[model samples]
Target: MKRNICWIVLLLVLAGCSSPPPIPYEAPTLSFTLNLPDYADESVKNSELQDALVQRGLVLDRFGRIVPLDEGSCLYPIATRTALLKELEQYQSSSFGYTLVSLKKQGDDYFFFPNDSRSQTLESLTLSFDSVLFDLTSIDKGTLVRDWTTHFAYLDQTLLVTGEQHKLLKKKHLSFALRNILIVTGQRASTVGELSMQFVDAIDTTRFLVLTHGDVLRSCQALTQGTMISTPTEPYSRESIKSQVKLVSLLPADADFNQLKQQQSLLSTGRYLTYRGDIATLIDRCSAGQGQSNQALCHSKADDSSARKKKVIVFGGKHGA
Candidate 1:
């Protein structure tokens, strides 16, 4: 009888050891500040700026109400205005004016909308859970139907996450991590559009995830390619490779709207695989290629113009002769 009891106890212990750890729970609070130039007093620019600020999740009141802003009442949560004002005093830029509005976390369950307020909710979707993974696949598909502004394309379907994948991410020391793959299907109308996947750090509440859609796509292709190739010296037939090598090449080197839109069309249906890792590395990679492409486009455009001008001069001389 004692032997049976001991065996039962050992089984319970082993089962407990194999179970996943419980996720910590804490309701998230939202806070942010908007800065507008003081010169924006009742001007059309000022009104536009206010609208822009509100669009980026700065319209919550202390009572958790989404309200319109008055000229001086642009401050949300109203409690952090003094701190924001103090922080703004350190600004040295003398370029254009800015109006400063800051969001302060007043209570639990209040969430800020960084994207479109009309599409996103003002309350925390992850409420009542400390660490949870929210699946975005469905939400993204639905949003695409309602919002014509987004362009999406399918590169390939990948398993969302596996036990091994979760273990890999956890080994990298990320908590409260979430992952999703979103395809930019339609063409982007503007050159300024960017794809960013960021997660708010549970410890410090700082958001991190700096890779662009291009960066992520290239990384995925390279990794998958390397895995399929058996040797470094092996020659790859272009047709055998399933990767879209031309998609990312179309990203504009400059900020020309027409050129940007044209290039974005090429990115339509490109596959981007998402991964979670060290925040510092992601930030470094994002900053490294920030404007290099745009600058290259500018230089290329200059060269073309110079060549055209020389041609015009030569044609005029030939006609005069």
Candidate 2:
């Protein structure tokens, strides 16, 4: 049953450990743990716990820690073990502070290498996350190895870690969060005469890379497209995403349609992703070019989504070594 404010207040008053953890830092980790109030009685703890468990798709671990088990919304934990055990796998997911990040996985660890728009190849800057370090095989239903997505799934307030407790997370190179990031988006057309979306990485203005879905315009039409951008999954609200990512449109609100068609944009010139390497490249089954069309723009009406029309498999587009 959902707990009302009164009940929550009552629990806080009655519980031995009422203080909740600090808001979690936005980073990938082994897994996120839920904070449970130590009620004065087992009956109260058990009753209030169910609401958090089902809402966040969490289960109690042997340690009495609430964790995501068989969570469909977040597959980071089981995505690896369930896939045919390939020697190499790629994980593409939205990051906190970053628009999108892809960690290359070989065996058991995933890694992140921060690079600029000029990144020609994907490299590892830090070992971001890996599930193998934890031996969950002994825990009941904890058989699947876990990663950082569990805590970030829905901005679960119960997962925040404050005080010295933040040190508990094993996230490496925490300074990487301080890196400057830029959000770039542009238009690309498709073979079907549809203006399917694609990403543009401006090597000049861009200090580091991140993608905004459309830079959507009247001339833009994303029939069915997917790219590594600042788009969110179903569990996220635009407000929540906006809080962490900063997006700027290459095409301004007062952009001239004719000038855009003539290869002009707010960048004061055209910026295109003409890379043959890996990082943030496009699998864009789309033809390259831009110009706004009222008809085409209104069809899909401009969205910052990973995939337009449908949310299918979106790769990080990490090409070569």
Candidate 3:
């Protein structure tokens, strides 16, 4: 009986020494919806906007009832992860101060380099939408063991970001803007990962010339349909087609006066303005680039007021300028 007790004790000790099984990882799927108010104009509201969306095959729920647009805006959930990510990527790239970091997914893990020593596992990164806090504890240490190049990893899961969640994202975006850091997040194998990069070595700037009304007319006359620059306008009569014209801010490129003049001459034949600033500054100004009332506010901090009056043509790439 004493011998049997010793053997049982030994077995219990061995069992206690063994590591516990890892928590079952449930891959997360992120869902998103379109903010109807963001797409709505004065004329397109309530049932009218719903009907238009329905015509476009964006009916909501099962009953085919129109998605309400009240309380800020209503969102229509997007089905494909690819399309949702693409739109989110575009918004991040276009928004001032925010930049998307490239991530590599191998099997059930996603990885990205920190590019800065300050960033670490879950301490420096977080992904939250609305009240839901995603699980990031499933980090793969093999990424660190195999190579020190990858700074972080997360188990694959799907992440859903509804329109309500977007408000939270915008708040986080504002936080990033204030901190002067690049925060990027993506949904992968049932998981969402957020990475912050502290250092950026390069950014590329691309330029486009804004053509004036006369310049547009002149170009239309000389250029063929294929080469002509078309400007979209709102309709006053008949069926209204979507307008291609979009408002964007222009920043002057880092070039000599002569080069700027030469490019202006080549691209435009009418009066125009030049903008020269970083991405963050440009976005801050352009957010207010609507209505006559906001025009003054947009131009309040301009380097030159004369240039602010002219229409803007957006220029510059996302990173490395």
Each prediction's TM-score versus the true structure: 0.16, 0.17, 0.18
lDDT of 2 by residue, 15-111 (tens): 8476665555443323322343331112445534433232322333333333232222221111112111121122222111112334333344433
Instruction: Please give the lDDT score at residue 12 for candidate 1.
Output: 100
Off by over 4 Å in 3: 1-47, 59-237, 240-321
Q: What is the C-alpha lDDT profile of model 3 across 285-320, one tens digit per residue?
A: 223335544445434533343231234444433422
- Ordered by TM-score, highest first, the candidates read 3, 2, 1
Model 1 C-alpha lDDT versus the unseen true structure:
0.27
The alpha-carbon deviation from the true structure for residue 264 of candidate 3, after best TM-score superposition, in angstroms, is 28
Over 1-321, each residue of candidate 1 has an lDDT whose tens digit, in order, gives 999999999999999999978765544443333443332233453343333223322222222222222222221111111122222232112211121221222232212222223212222322322121222223333332333122112212111222333344346543332332212222222222232322212122232222122222222222232121111111122231232222112221111111223333333433122222111111111123546664454345433432311222121211111
Better of 1 and 2 by lDDT: 1
Model 1, which residues run further than 4 Å from truth? 1-110, 114-122, 128-214, 217-234, 238-321
Q: Each model's number of backbone clashes?
A: 25, 6, 28
